[model samples]
Target: MVPAIESVGIGRLATCLREAGLLLLLALSVTVAAWLIRPEKMSLRAETAFYELELDAPLIAVADALVLYDTGSHLFLDTRTAGPGSFVTIPGALPVRVTTFDDDLYENRDFLYPEDPVVLFGDGNLPAVSDVAALLLERGFEEIMIMGGDLEAWRRTGGPLADHQAGEHE
Candidate 1:
């Protein structure tokens, strides 16, 4: 009654092709919609530095603490991105680059030497700051203080900050 059929499922093959086309169209539609309505970035006014951290305790006020070491007291550290914060720092702090840098900053023979309190700083917050403090502690430093509030707090309060117009390169 029926003509000789060369393929068993010619009709089914056509239906499958139609379904595949529909699925492709749906996927493309979703992709386009997602691109048109993407989420926005954060607007919070915040800054960042070499690391992110939460200090275990508050550091003694830079002004009244006399953080600056005379010979074997304490060491001021500015752990911000180097070459930029040359001037920006705590009132009585000094700059120290801790970017796996192999220079005098990492050396143990500097004037401050070992067994001194080293105050570390960051832009918004320094990452692995506790580890750095621990390293300094292992090196005989008595106390390692991690400064809070970061560069934003320091600049907003008009602390010892540099005025140079650091460009995007920084």
Candidate 2:
């Protein structure tokens, strides 16, 4: 009876080990197959223009931005996402969502003329603004500048803010 029980236990252990080995082998085979079938080359520009934009767009200090705003010589594009509550934006800044940049550009084509000097600003890090700047460059916007600081910086510098409530006439 001891010998019979030993034999059963050994058989179950062997079966479990064999199944585990097969599963591991299957996973390895699938991984190798996927690796081999993956594309060998991709266009970096086509895939991510923003990466290039980071290298190209010039950074503008808050003081310079204030000067530009006062002169009204350049268009101010705010790339921040609208948050809950009344929208507070920089005076004369056009709200631009990076996700809908192309549509927004088309809708505001008159203001976003290709030749105009455009200044982009958003949260301090400038991720959304950078992306929008890249898209603008791709669309033939020649002069794009990224504001050095964010909304807080603008506030700190005494930049004017306007309440942009929906349904209210500007």
Instruction: Superpose all Cα atoms of candidate 1 onto the true structure and report the RMSD in Å to 1 decimal.
Output: 16.5
lDDT for 129 (candidate 1): 50
Q: Estimate, for each residue in 32-126, the C-alpha lDDT of model 1 and write its tens digit.
A: 77766644222245544422435543454333233243343556665565564335444545444456423534443444566665766666444
Candidate 2: C-alpha lDDT: 0.76
* Alpha-carbon deviation at 126 in model 2, angstroms: 1.7
lDDT of 2 at 48: 46
- For TM-score, the strongest prediction is 2
**Which 10 consecutive residues of model 1 have the lowest summed lDDT?**
161-170
* Model 2 per-residue lDDT at 26: 100
**Model 2 weakest 10-residue run by lDDT:** 40-49
TM-score of each: 0.45, 0.62
Off by over 4 Å in 1: 1-73, 83-87, 106-108, 163-170
